[model samples]
Target: MKRIRASVIQPLLPDDDVAERHGWTSVEDPFDTELDHEKVFFNEYLTLAMRVDRWVVPGPLLKAHLREAEEKLLEKKSLERLGRKAKADLKVMVLKKLRRQLVPVTKSYDLVWNVNDGVAFFFSHSNKTHELVQELFERTFKLRLLVESPGTAADRRGLVAEEQRAFAALEATSLATMEVAS
Candidate 1:
């Protein structure tokens, strides 16, 4: 219980942002994986890194192992066939066991927040990574974030009513070269 209190109290937080982000992002020397406020703030920039671990098990490999396990169990029990529910249960058990022995793939992303400008940059383009960053950032700061866009940036900078309408009126321009049939 004491360890839990210090070492990132929550592991998974897909729904609850505040409760999940208590210690997951706000930390000094984030490279050490210690999520807490020690030396987090440095000048106008708030920089941190997030590490994600995922276990990827091959479907064919899992299926083969499950088949072997089911056959062994049936043979040991002297049974002709196992029930569907029993097979499903066995598959789950086998998967859990295999998952323990497998190594997890780790991914890390860095975030730089310029508080003065109220702008934060996440150094990745992956949609999946973007979602994770969004969740982590909102939870840590308890402030809503808008995805980066020209309009949003203008709005964030407190654009005047006239500039806002001008920005809204802009249309896409084509850069294609035209052929001159002389």
Candidate 2:
């Protein structure tokens, strides 16, 4: 049996220290200057693994399995991007045709999967668009889905990992050095 695990990441409210670390201003401030829109970005990660008891599938079969998974994931991503663009265009169309200030809703989502763990995960920031995300997965992958809040421990661990990754990247850059050795 293959196992899949996924989580939708919510934006953490930036504390003073966190803001300084990330060079961010107030957490409530909009990411972009336009429209004073406070944006929330969502990220998803998944790990997949096959049961050890099960015999390893042949190379051809494994390739087929991976290809199918990739195709489905790509299709879903394309649809989501298209939907967002269409909605934006529709908003413009509505404003021009009706002369009303109606704003069309838009959402962003992310998904990442690890075949080694046999897990797939998805994340969406918009609660209203989550149903659509779930429905798309079910239709494309034939997998039933459920949403649950992450435990405090898991959330903490994730945050720590993110901080470590960011620090590692910074350390790799010459900009972090104090003086030239020359």
Q: TM-scores across all candidates? A: 0.69, 0.25
lDDT of candidate 2 over 1-182, digit per residue (tens): 01111222123322211211111121233222121112222233232111111112245644554455445655877643335565555433433432222222222344444435434465445665456556544653567555645443344455677776664465333565456654
lDDT of 2 at 21: 11
Regions of model 2 farther than 4 Å from truth: 1-96, 99-105, 115-118, 149-182
Mark the 10 consecutive residues where model 1 has the least summed lDDT. Answer: 13-22
- Residue 40 in candidate 1, Cα distance off native in Å: 2.0
Residue 73's lDDT within candidate 2 is 52
**Which predicted model would earn the best lDDT?**
1
| CA shift of 8, model 1, Å | 3.8
- Model 1 gets an lDDT of 0.65
Return the lDDT, model 1, position 108: 66
Quick one: RMSD of model 2?
24.0
Instruction: Count backbone overlaps in model 1.
Output: 1
Model 1, 149-170: lDDT tens digits are: 7778688878889988988999
Clashes of each: 1, 9
In model 1, which regions exceed 4 Å deviation?
1-31, 76-87, 175-182
